[model samples]
Target: MSPAHVLEPTYDTLRRRLLMGAWPAGQRLEAARLAADLGVSITPVRDSLNRLTGERLIVSQPGDGFHVPRLDEAGLRGLLDWHHAIVTMALGRERAGRPDEFQLTGGDLPERSAHLFASLVARARDEELDWAIENAAARLGRFRHHEAAVLAEADKDVGAIERMMDEADSPGLRAAIDYHHDRRRSAVDQLIAASRGGQII
Candidate 1:
């Protein structure tokens, strides 16, 4: 709606479109056109895009307008490394000896692992998710650009990413991190191959 929220409906709309790969990387986006496309005025769109730019999901050239931020292998690895460190520090056995070690809370990951992951994936398709605990996964554009790559390359170890979050072995967790990368690389590779052939995976 209006620009009051500055980052809600407008931001969400853009993030989802990006996650769906609706636009190619480096394609410039004009706020007015995007506003028209979203059926709203340019104000909200500008504000929303500003927020994404702050998150490094969009880039603003000196005079070339705004475009989706493209990620290289280095950028991808940086994000994955953050995931590994955060997950390990927050839930690692060495740190707190596992959140599971403490018996409480109303969460049911062990019982509803598949359902939760599925829901997360669906939400991902519709919008962005923070993938952090305290934040409870708010929609943010940071991960959308990498979704296709993560999914395609990550197929071989989908189960393991879930396992790393659920299991508490230090070594296993470490392996799961690498496995996560291999899977994403696989997914990205497939997407790239398809792209080269003028198709999508």
Candidate 2:
């Protein structure tokens, strides 16, 4: 297979793992170890790591290897704020036309939440905006499971968002989006603490 073919799967697998909080924040990633685990060569692993670093999913030091980023309170809050802003913008654009249909696919709240926001952004049909929202979602993915613990009836909130999307209720959707993000923003400290404690769901 070509190098790109070899690298694509490795990159995707690593990205998924990172987004899913497979490794704890701040833990160093060893290319060799990951290569062995994935049954690939170190070159592909290193290349994948570099790609993730650029995406801000992995942090790279000058002399040190790549590591999973640790989202502190301020950092997490900033991401949430940025995500909410762009999502709000996307919602505005989407409202200009008939909202595009999207299917939510995930077994858990975190995955469902990510898919929900992604669907919202996708409806806007702006590549740049889509990229922005997706990046934020990836960074926020690890902490989403904590939402279940911190926010009451988190699943209900997601269900409501889905319902609004289905009914094309733009105003209610916007309000629900605000409420969802605001609730998470208010509980950032608790979310970060739960993540640090390695509590998933």
Candidate 3:
């Protein structure tokens, strides 16, 4: 295979591992070790690491190599803010032809919802914005992997947002956006606390 073709899957696999919280926050990642684990040479692993660094999913420190970023509340807020703006714009544009209520299931609700929002944002016809939304979603790491109650609550919140969009209630949409962020922040806070209470990563 071509170099690009060979490296693309490796990049994707590494991205999935990060998003799934395979590595602990702030865990150092040695390319040589990863290359050995993935049964590949260091070259592809290095290329994949470079791509992840570009996405802000992996941070490279001078003389220290790459590491998964430590979870940060401030960074989370910034990402939520970015998500809010892009989603609001996309919803506004889709208001004229809003579809039926979002049909969300329970298991994997967070990942599914992220995909749904990413799809909605894609309707904005801006590739850069779409990619940004996806990146932000993936960078969420284990924060969204909550209990059943949290997942159910998130499903409900998305339904409310969908209803607001269908009703063309701009104010309601804005409110829903705030509600979503607030709920997500609360969930993350709880998860952080629980993690500190002996739940590793």
State TM-scores per candidate. 0.61, 0.91, 0.79
Q: Give one digit per residue, the lDDT tens place, for model 3 in 17-121.
A: 887667767789999999999888899999999889998998998899999887566766676677777777776665345554545444475576676677667
Clashing pairs in 2: none
Tell how far residue 55 is off in model 1, in angstroms: 0.7
In model 2, which runs have C-alpha deviations exceeding 4 angstroms?
A: 167-169, 198-201
TM-score of 2: 0.91
Q: Is candidate 1 or 3 superior in TM-score?
A: 3
lDDT (tens digit, per residue) of candidate 1 on 83-192: 44444444332333223222222322222322333332332222323234212222222332344353644333544555454554457755865665445444544443
lDDT of 3 at 187: 62
Count of backbone clashes for each model?
Answer: 7, 0, 0
Task: Put down candidate 2 lDDT per residue, 1-201, tens digits, no spaces.
Answer: 329989999999998887777777788999999999999999999999988899999899989889888888899989999999998888777746566676768688888988888888888789999999889998898788668778889899889898788655457888899999888998888877776775534
User: Which regions of candidate 1 fall more than 4 Å away from where they truly are?
Assistant: 5-7, 91-153, 163-165, 185-201
| Candidate 3 ranges beyond 4 A from true positions | 93-107, 147-152, 159-174, 193-201
Find the candidate with the highest lDDT and give its number.
2
RMSDs, each prediction?
Answer: 7.8, 2.3, 3.6
Instruction: Evaluate all candidate structures by whole-model CA lDDT and list the values in order.
Output: 0.51, 0.85, 0.70
